[model samples]
Target: MADLEAKPPLSPSSTLEKQFEDFRHHLEESESLRERIRAVAREIESVTRLIYSCLLLVHQSRPIPEVLEKVKAQISKLKELFHRLAGILRECPGQYYRYHGDWRSETQTVVSLLGFMHWLETGNLLMHTQVEERLGLKTSEFGLDIEDYLIGICFMSNELPRYVVNQVTAGDYDCPRKVLKFLTDLHAAFRMLNLRNDLLRKKFDGMKYDLRRVEEVYYDVKIRGLTANGDSTRDLGIQGQS
Candidate 1:
């Protein structure tokens, strides 16, 4: 009772200083996370570039088997890098879309490359599920974005015209007809999407040109009677003359 000393309450200035310190700490942590993400992104870019280079052999008209064999190693490396990216994203939880821009373009390119490769081998569009599976991504936090998948498919469509042209130039005239049918279906499917995304809309617009170019190529091959059976081309010619 003789020693009635009371503890002083925290001053407003001190409280403010404490809050500022916390703010600073948070900013530092966010910056640190950004730096780490950038580092991982650089590694992902390197792996992606390697994978792209391997895939480019297709444009060289290299045998598909040989191209696939060479691309397999890069694909393994890409999957590892993607897993590492997913792990990093896990640390921040709920912030995936924030950093998604960092990797979105590269991911689109990877998807396009893989989609082209799969189409070459299977004559089918690689589904988004298959892409996630190939990349070893979990559907929960690291699923491939639907926009990225669609954009990638558009990019793959752009490749088909060039590929058909190359194949025709290489005397594989059957390629144009097959590619034309595939692109026609793909274009129609894309038209069904209610796309509001400007970039994707632009890409889909380009797909029409791609379809047209392939159709032109198919017609070129048909008019020349270069189809594998020549029967359809001859029939078309007969109809045209009549």
Candidate 2:
């Protein structure tokens, strides 16, 4: 009977205060997650830059074996960073796409660099599955985005024309034929996808120019009889622009 004193039916004001507190807690948690994602993204960007620098050594005309050796450390670092990214994402399960933009550009760069390296070593395009395996992304939750992979392949294509030009200038006339074939195949493969993404479409468009440039170089070498089997094979060793 003493306890029957009404507890004021839980005042409306008190109910509102409880609701406000819940909202504040959720807001704080959301901010915390955003901050954490940003921090991880920055770290990923840094490691990606290092990986890019290693890939740049390829442009220096260093032997592929040596370039691969130098990049091995950076590639390992990148894998670790990706693992860290995956860990952070696990904290918010089922929201991989939600935070994907945070690291989208860097992931594309990584894919481009890795794809280029793989091509150098094996004379083939790096498959998406191989990229996932290299990055230790064994789960669907954090697997490489297909669009990013395709875009990265486009970026890799951009590198080849320059590489071919450089190799030709360095007296490697055979380089253009090899690079032209690669770019031609890559461009055709990219055309197979029905890309709705504007950025991807733009990048693919640029690939056409790259293919044309490489083709021009290949024709120059071919028509001038500068190939290894041609009359100017000896003169082909002279360094000059394509």
Candidate 3:
């Protein structure tokens, strides 16, 4: 009786084809969305590069206010691109991470550029919230990932050894001391985290080298008895008399 009342199996020719056709359509839509996301990410990366180039003027000891102004001028353009990316991702609700890889590198680079800028302007680490706020990212909708932000910070640290060298050559002898302090504190803060990210862990390791370079610079300055607090005459006079 039970066997007689059982329903028939779905037709392989009709139902299977329909199911596969649905799968095919879904894949096409996802690919289309990914391409759109990639387009926006490319633009964002271009803008990030522009900002990074502008900030490179720092290595030349360019005026902080001027470098910052040039970088800031590009902020609105970045914000608009990010907004467009968010709009595209919104098509797939609750799936931001699904396509995260499509734009992860670009986002990390942008954060590094912005982090470097903020450090130059204020001599402080750019907090994650500040990144979102400055980029005009709606936190509840689309937010900056913590790992990306941390990785960006590591990139920013890579700039410091060169920066310290440049600043010292430019006669800012006291710069190394300040940078050393900051890097030391930053390194300590990183130690507190159990950084499991392979890239982040590697970056954190490189930061040690940055700290060491700054330390050497600071030591050289201190031992030379070079007064870097703008007392140029006294510094020269003491060195000459010695």
Pick by TM-score: which candidate is best?
3
lDDT of 3: 0.85
* Local distance difference test values of all predictions, in order: 0.82, 0.82, 0.85
| TM-score (all chains, Cα) for each model | 0.87, 0.85, 0.88
Kindly report which residue stretches of model 3 are placed more than 4 angstroms away from their true locations once superposed.
1-9, 227-242
lDDT, candidate 1, 1-242, per-residue tens: 53568667789999999999999998998788877777777887787777677777777688989988887778887798889888888889999898888888888888888899899998888999999999999889899999999999998888888888888888788887777767766776786899999999999998888888887888877778777664453332222210
lDDT of 2 by residue, 33-52 (tens): 87787787788788777777
The RMSD (Cα, Å) of candidate 1 is 4.6
RMSD to true structure for each model, in Å:
4.6, 5.7, 6.4
Q: Kindly report which residue pairs in candidate 3 clash with one another.
A: none
Give the CA lDDT, 0 to 100, for residue 38 in model 1. Answer: 78
Number of clashes found in candidate 2: 0
Q: After aligning candidate 2 to the native by TM-score, how far in Å is the CA of 156 from where it should be?
A: 1.2
Model 3 C-alpha lDDT per residue in residues 42-145, reported as the tens digit of each score: 99988988888888899999999988987888999988998999899888999899999999999888888888888887888999999999888887889898
